[model samples]
Target chain A: MKEEIQDNLIQIHDLRISIYSEGSYFDVVKGLSLSVCSNEILCLVGESGCGKSITALSVMGLLPTDVAQVTNGEILFRGQDLLKLSASDMRRLRSDEISMIFQDPITSLDPVFTIGSLLTEIIRVHRNVGSSEAENMAVDALEAAQLPNARQRLKSYPHELSGGMRQRVMIALATALNPAVLIADEPTTALDVTVQAQILERLRERQREQKMGMLLITHDLAVVAEVADRVAVMYAGEIVEEASVQTLFDKPQHPYTQGLLGAIPDITARRGSLHAIPGRVPPPQVPPPGCEFAPRCVHALEECWESRPLLEGSGEGKLRCFNPQPLIT
Target chain B: MLIVLLISSVAVFYAIRLSGGDATAAALPGSATEEFREEFRARIGLDKPIYLQYFAYMGKILKGDPGHSITNNASLVEMLKEHGKNSLVLGGAAFALVFLIGVPLGVLASLRRNSWADHGIMSFSIAGMAIPNFWLALLAIWLFASTFRILPAAGCCSGKQLILPAIVLAFEGIALTVRMTRSAMIENQNNDFVRTLRAGGLSEWRVMGKHVLRNAMIPIISLAGLRIGQIVGYALIVEQIFSWPGIGQALVTAVLRRDYPVAQFFSLVLVVLVVLGNWLADTGYTLANPRLRRSR
Candidate 1:
């Protein structure tokens, strides 16, 4: 158990992020904690505006400093606190130790730069290699990402390629340096259904081959079911429930998690009306008292409205609910 | 471009003719008799109808003969060659000053955005846009030439004399370029690509200079081209103020004296240069952005 805990490449401890707007600051990610281990995929599932992307940005130290801030937290990467590291030191660690791919591939790459230049520059930034060597490495990365005509594609600009191809290039760039951890924030969201599978496959292949701890952020439960080793369900800036993929799917403990599982469109059942949670995720600035999901949860108890529950668990999973739903079967 | 020059020349010719000025009278002495004026007008081909005179002028221009000034009989081509050199020099110096100073300063201001430096640059740009160039030219002469006695007050014989007028001409251009560069860069800085670059651990300088600035330069290049055209118009007034012997001064003198051939040729040249500047800007826009190139 100790060895497994120690094997985590990145462990975020009680990270609280705040966003400034108009006049005052609002707590967005309220004391969230999660960990990513080598040879595993941890999917952080949440709807839009639930602070998932900002959390990923905070991990990369790429948050917009003027608007968002990490008020309290410790992001420990391999035992060193990332938040305490100097800007230069943090920069040295980025892409070399941990890298990221954004949601929209079309706008994520510089339109003016050729694929070869963009890839080669990144390789050269961290390595003391000549241009030719960097180019060779870039070609290799492109090939690994299953891009056809990898060498020829080097001369291509971002707009010249299809959305799927660009996402593959993004995957190539993020994994080229063989970082220990990769944060893919809805990487395939902008892609078509057919292209999404291919991108996910390539991403999984890279993550497994490199033994990289990948933190995949997405709102799609089908994606979570397909790619996640562990699943963490976030509601209103808090992780309501987290478990192994099988455990989370088979027996979702928290009421919010149960509602999410029920909301997935079922093909077998005769469809009369789709299942939907009653209410929406509360705004960060005006979250309801006690459990943030109380208004939306169907099985909320009286105690759930008085005080928030801490994330408590042992070996199999964690649940932050005073009134957890009964286990099925 | 050639079509634009032709249309512009025709318009200038008719407009100048309809202004009710007799070129023959301007060319002749005040004591000349009506019969002598009639002979002078007939000698210069002004006795023909307006459209016929335009056709003759256009035919002569097509054959590379700009004709002679009605006032002095000096070849219009020769006057153009001599004075065009000075305008070219002044315009080039002004453009050089605009880009060399505006781009870097704009980059710095954007990188340090919302800081005192950015505020200062923006405030200076507003002031630059508000102040009149001719008034600024006079003040510059007063400060640098009359008061400090460091630079020459007027004329274009020495390189030192080019400084005051060039600065005056480039002031608004620099201000506009700075504003454009800053806003363009700031907009590009917010793009998803910049975040990708930063996440990839590229240095801030690399992210900003190589990617952001390059993207921002597309619009800035077009602005630069438009500014070049505007500088010609500004040069007219700036030249009159500084007494610098440029084509602008020549055009004004020709207009006042009703030197038809000289004025018509200079107006055509100005139109051609402005159109050519826009063409260059369009070409530069395509070159700077690969997306545009691929689309074509």
Candidate 2:
């Protein structure tokens, strides 16, 4: 267990984020804890507005200051607390130690810059390298991302490339510096199914090549099944379950995780309809007094409505529920 | 573009002609006999049908001859060349002042957004835009010329004298440019790419100065070109206040003196300048935006 904790490249502890809107602040991410271990991909599975993107931004120190604030908790990168770093220190650590790729590839790159300049600039910023050396490194990164005509693509602007190609460029850019940790927020959500597979393959290949820890955020369960080594299910800003991907998919304990697994449309089943969790995730501004998923759970007991459940468990797994669904055979 | 010029020339010719004063009557004195007036009208070809008169005027213009001023008999082309240079100098100085001051001030305001400096700069710009140039000109002359004894009260052709009127002309332009730069920078700063740049470990200066400013320059360059045309329009009043010898002052004089050829020539020049300004802006827009460049 101690060795496992030491292997984590990025560990987030009880992170709470608040967004100021209209007149007051609301907790968007309540005391959420997760980690990304070296050579493993931890898929943060959640629906939109469940604070997945916010969590990623906080780790990168890219959250907009006027709107969102990290009210509590620490994000530790390799045993150093990132939240305590100064602005310049955080900037220095970013792209050099940790990097990120965003969801929409269309708007992720600067339209006015050529692909060559964009890649070269990031390379030069993080490493003490000249332009020619940086250019070579950029070409290598592009090739690593499996981009075709990598050398010729240097002069092309973002608009000149197709969506898939741009996303490839984004992946190349994020991995260019060979950071220890990579945070990808729905990286394949904007691509077609074929392109999505290719991009995910590239990401997994990059992780294996570098032994980098990756926090892959996605709402698609199929994607979770494909690339995740471990899975953390989030509902309304809190983790409901954490386990090995096989365990989570085969025997989802938390009611929310079960509902998520059941909601995935199965091609082999001759069914009446797909299963959907009954109620929506409650808004953070006015959350109910108990477990956030209790109102939507089929196994909610009388005690589930009284108070929130602590995340408690033994080795390799954790569960936060008053009454969890029974294990499947 | 040629079609627009042709249409504007026709409008200028007819509008000046229909402005309720006979060219022959304005040229000849009341003591002159009807025979003298008739001879003058025939000499200038005004006795012909109105359409023929218009055609004659156009032919002369196409031949690079705008006829002569009715009051002084000076060549209209020579007058335009002399006065056009002064207008160019004044307008150029005013334009330079507008951008050099406005852009940096805008950047500062945006960087310090919602601070006291931002509020102060914005409030000043609002007041600058609200004040009329004529009023501002008068106030400047009173303060700088009459009170301080620093500048000449009214005149032109000197660097020192250029200062007062140029500031008066550039006041509104500076205000407009500030608003434009600040808003454009703020808008681009909110774009998704900004976050990408930040997450890429770029320094705040490089991100804001290089990327954000480059995107912001698209609208700014367009505004700059349009402002050049507006400066010339505003020059008419500014020159009148300063008694500066420019094309605008020349146009006003020609109109009051009923110098038809000179008035028509100067008006056409102003129209051509405005059209040229818009063309420059379109070219600048294409240059600043890569997407537009690739589309073309």
Candidate 3:
């Protein structure tokens, strides 16, 4: 119990989530484990349909009840299993203990409400504050997100602001309370590159100032290189490699990570040809029997096709591969 | 708005042509001779060019006089003052019923989606829309007034007298409102903002009440204007069937008698009501979504 205090701010332990559709159920998120500790940024990098977004939603206890369910495992937040918590308790824990900012700012806000009401309502909901205090908090949050005209922008509706401005508003709303853990699901993906950099910088700065644990989910390797303290490379709904960012970038241990790194454009690559993995991610209904990435791996051996390999390594780094891809550096 | 009304008057001007000739002369009593008709026409300046006659009519309207009715020689303003009051009250009550029942039923039907509650409310609205208001008015009279000996069958003098007709008028409006509200809610249900609201740690009730309803309001309000137009149109038929003596019933009588001044006056008032109704709906959307106001 004493050791658990230093364990994690939010830890996902063997979490498995399944989606039900048209008389069949498929596990969108296989048995997975990860954690983000205080003052750290953990990047979860995965392509679309690999269950990155669903995993984020499950942490907030907001998965659509009719379509998806947590079949097994638990999400431990501050040592309490979030899966077993009451709905009312989860409601209170959210926005106060953990908050989330989503990808598309255009449709992520209630278009009918002004920013003032949207931000202040959350403050009033969690704290016994007067309207003036709530207003002050909202203005402070807007300014913290590095937005201009914070006072006037409070009265602007979602549609009145530009996409970048709206994303900033979302950041302000999510971070006003300074929660222990912040889940940002591709928050900068919908913005142009210039705005993207500014948004991420603000996010990193806020994380540093507040020392909040951040689970930043994105498939942009560039983003991973820029802000990740640690990186978990996901393929086919499973984490294939986990390590400190420097180690993962310099000495990727799994073939899938190697393929991803190789796929990045390089000046040395010859014309009309690029190095990319040959196959697509297998459909959930037809996943490979063993290692999920085996079909696309160049290092696949006989036993790699026969059984799923458990994640193995020291606490500092890990890899799940039967035939490893050694570093060239 | 005044220009729009003036343009709409061209349609009304054509309507007079469809009635054959000067409705003023044709509307004279059978006992009156040609001498009286000519004198009456000249007195109203009907011998002038068409544009002059139109200007004369417009000028008359501006002076707070709606002219004399050819039906009973009653002042057009006085007849409308009495009968229009009845129609206005009935229209207001029916409009209230449109939202009071329609909005709630719509919200529930949408929230429940394909459940039994959704099916039930939808089927009820379909039946409401399918059943003719005149037929329903007769049935309401038979059941609530004639058979049960409870509510009065006709007239707008008493509160009880209005029940049968008001219900008949509101039935279709409720149906229309339900369909609009349901479709709007369903459209907004998949919106990403709704998901964002839920992730804010807000309760389910607040999300649905504040967010879903607000996003769904623009369509609901726009449909309400269309519903008001249909209600006014149906009120004409419903008033006749129930012998309610409302403005719509009197307008029908005026049209049938080809009472030119009175018919034109009724058409003008109705057009105003519709324009005003649409204006109110637009105002509602702006108030509901502040983005529209900022753009304005």
Whole-model Cα lDDT of every candidate shown, in order:
0.91, 0.91, 0.87
Could you tell which candidate, 1 or 3, scores higher by lDDT?
Answer: 1
Question: What TM-score against the true chain A does chain A of each candidate get?
Answer: 0.98, 0.97, 0.97
Residue A204's lDDT within candidate 2 is: 97
Q: Write the per-residue lDDT of candidate 3 for residues B1-296, one digit (tens) a residue.
A: 77778887767855774667555555676788878888887886666777777877888898998799866789988888899989988888899999999988999999999999999999999999899888888899889888998988887668888877888899999998898889888898889887777777888788887788878888787667777788788888988988878878888888888887878888888887787777777777777767777774
lDDT of 1 by residue, B14-106 (tens): 887887888876888899999999998888788999999999888988899988888888988888899999999999999899999899989
lDDT by residue (B1-296, candidate 2, tens digit) is 78988898889888988897877667878788988888988898878887888888889888999888989999888998899999999999999999998988898899899999999999989989999999999999999999999999789789999999999999999998888889999999998999888989999999999999999989999767789889989999999999999999999998988888889899999989988888889899989988999873
Q: Second chain TM-score per prediction?
A: 0.97, 0.96, 0.92
Superior candidate under TM-score, 1 versus 2: 1
Docking class of 1: high
Off by over 4 Å in 1: A327-329
TM-score of 2: 0.96
DockQ of candidate 1 compared with the true complex = 0.87
The global Cα lDDT (0 to 1) of model 1 is 0.91
